[model samples]
Target: MASKLTMTPGEILREGELEKRSDSLFQLWKKKRGVLTDDSLRLFSGTSERAKELRFHSILKVDCVEHTRKYVYFTIVTTDFKEIDFRCTGESCWNASITLALIDYQNRRAVEGFRRHRFQRAASEAEEEPESPEQRALSP
Candidate 1:
């Protein structure tokens, strides 16, 4: 069955609580590690600065999930900004480089997902085609 609830970039952005939700999400990402400290803000600030410059703050939709090995994956969608997909797997909050890397990775994942979904639709259409008359003639 086709999903009635289709999410659009515009709709996600128009939501009133996006910024609050985004801040909350960042907090959750930090809380998941069970330690809240200045180091976390430092790491977040650096990452967010780069993201802001890259326009990630204009993001429309953001999704995050915890992977099997204590890693958290983040997916984000934006207007002029490209989609980001990344995973964080550092025990120490002081690892700013790793945090930045994960952010970049997540951005890549969002772009990849867009490409993947398009390819999947095309593949599904190709697979359901009826046999052509030309092919039947050639076979005989």
Candidate 2:
């Protein structure tokens, strides 16, 4: 792995062997060593060559979970409908980690968004309503 790939900022969870599913004649499912972080997954063909990246926030869905006697396979679907496949040795935690990380990221975003919306709504409501005498006197 190159320093460039390792420099991505996030809580690095798993970094080892993961294979991308390829269907083309020239490309087949070949195993590659890459880095998986809380915010993104990055793969490289060579140490200095960047191949692909799947960022958690931009991901729209995760699908295609298939298990065999040897490995666990899954796909990370992006917002643009790009499906990137990944697999780890049998009974490994790679798939689970990816799913959980993405879910956690989404849940955090939802919480922040809801809080922001509520805060704005409260501010507007306060501006539209007159302060009661009790509140006014309590203020000063």
Candidate 3:
């Protein structure tokens, strides 16, 4: 399988076979090897040379549609509102894995964004604020 698809970088949170619903008129369920990473979910089908990646930044949410005795059905909703359906064995817990990874990625991005904005605001404020008269005199 490694020869069929190149492995993506990052920690592998989980990896297993997943059934994905095709977008064709029949909407047939096809089995594919799924690799869950910190930053993306990579799906490899058949002998394809490349894996289709669903990056964390582009993902909006994961909706658990239903859970049967044998399988757990779920949907991955993207930022553009496209929903990709998938199902895995009940014990596989692919949905939970993907959801957790997505949440972690989003939280990290939010914190980084907040820090950048706060630093920029502080710098602007410091430049705009007037120095005290005594401090100004001491600066020569």
lDDT of 1 at 81: 60
How does residue 106 of candidate 2 score in lDDT?
Answer: 86
Candidate 2, run of 10 with poorest lDDT: 1-10
The residue-by-residue lDDT of candidate 3 on 56-103, one tens digit each, is 989999999999999999999999999999999999999998998888
Best by TM-score: 3
Clash count, one per candidate: 7, 0, 0
* Candidate achieving the largest lDDT: 3
Off by over 4 Å in 3: 1-9, 134-140
TM-score, cand. 2: 0.77
Writing each residue's lDDT as its tens digit, candidate 2 over 89-123 gives: 87666777777777867877899999999999999
Model 1: what TM-score?
Answer: 0.27
TM-score of each: 0.27, 0.77, 0.87
lDDT tens digits, residue span 50-91, model 1: 322223335454555444465546555555665554445534
- What's the lDDT for residue 135 in model 2? 89
Window of ten residues with lowest summed lDDT in model 3: 1-10
Global lDDT scores for all candidate models: 0.41, 0.76, 0.90
Once fitted onto the true fold, the runs of candidate 1 whose alpha carbons sit more than 4 angstroms away are 1-103, 138-140
The residue pairs found clashing in candidate 1 are: 84-106, 84-107, 85-105, 85-106, 85-107, 86-105, 86-106
